[model samples]
Target: MAQQDRAVQTRERIVTGAATAFYRVGYADASIATIAETAGVTKGALYFHFSSKEEIARAVIDEQHRRVFESAAEILQATASPAETMMLMCADLAEWLVSDVVVRAGIRLTTGGAIFDPPTRAPYDDWLATFEDLVGRAVAAGELRQGTDPARLAHFIIPSFTGVQLLSDVLTNMDDLKVRVGELWDVLLAAFAEPTRLDELLALRFRIFGPAS
Candidate 1:
């Protein structure tokens, strides 16, 4: 049992170390030596867990998607309002990207042309489905204006958010991501929220983003 646990820990260390290297440098630039050093493992240990940088990159991407869904599920369980839940989820993810090296690596890998056989779109489609369900709930609750197409709105929001996140990463290393998310929500709420509840939703936004927002 102890040996198994140690093996698991070593594998995780390699994955995490590789993630930090990938986050700091593009996949093309990150080297096995850097990953081994960052992970505090020998090259042999890393090779035991992963055959190549490509395998490690794929692991990081899988971990990122897992974390994204896990965090959203936790928030959904805690928040009754779907609109508020969506905002909170985005805020959490923005902060996560800032602090979590593994998550950051995954985002970079996806954007930087790292190819995986199963493809990355499958996870994105699941995410879109989650967002669409939330939007559908918000529409049903009358938080959004009538005639709002939940599917279309969800599809739009996800890609718009991807652009916002990617641009923030490029321009600010995601230092401004939380604020950018607030901005995105501001426009989204203005466009789709029911007139009677727009003010209330905006107030929620301010509370979430702070009065400075």
Candidate 2:
């Protein structure tokens, strides 16, 4: 039992260390020896827990996906008006990308050609599929526009966000992101709102994103 606990600790240490290294150096530059040094373990210990640097990179990406989904689900499940919910969800998504080191690195690696190997793309694609499903659910529930093609929208939005995040990576200040997203969300909702809501749409935009005037 004691041995098992120590083993678990060692594995967790490796995971955390690898995540940090990947964030700092990127997947291409990160190495198992560096990870082992960061984790305060030998190369053999890293191999004992993870077979290769690629495996460790996959683990890092998977962990980022898990954390992202968990946070997104929590926000989606909360009780709120559809507009409010959508805003919160987008804001939370941005915050997660900007705040989480592993998530930021994983996003860059998956989208920026850091790890283009077939094995890596599969897991990355799976993550995008999961994201699309969540967006589809939000659309079905009327939180987003029903006419919105979730997969297509996701392809566009995800990459746009990836670009924005990469830009945000250099900016540090989040106010610009928040303001720009607020404007864009207003535009998206205007295009997608049901016809009847058109009468009050401008007001709704004001409520959701603040006064245009």
In candidate 1, which residue ranges exceed 4 Å CA deviation?
114-119, 211-213
Name the regions of candidate 2 deviating beyond 4 angstroms: 81-83, 119-151, 170-177, 195-213
lDDT of each: 0.85, 0.67
All-Cα superposition RMSD per candidate: 1.7, 4.1
What is the RMSD, in Å, between candidate 1 and the native fold over all Cα? 1.7
lDDT of 2 by residue, 1-213 (tens): 699999988987887788778877766788778899988889988888888887877777777777776886787689865555555656676777767777766666666654556645654465467557766765666666667787886676556655665665667544456555666666666666555554454464456545432
TM-score of 1: 0.93
lDDT of 1 by residue, 1-213 (tens): 699999999988888888989877778888999999999999998998899888898888888878877988899899459889888888888878888888888877776654555556756687789889999998888898888888899899888888888999999988788888899999999899999989988988887865433
The per-residue C-alpha lDDT of model 2 at residue 58 equals: 72
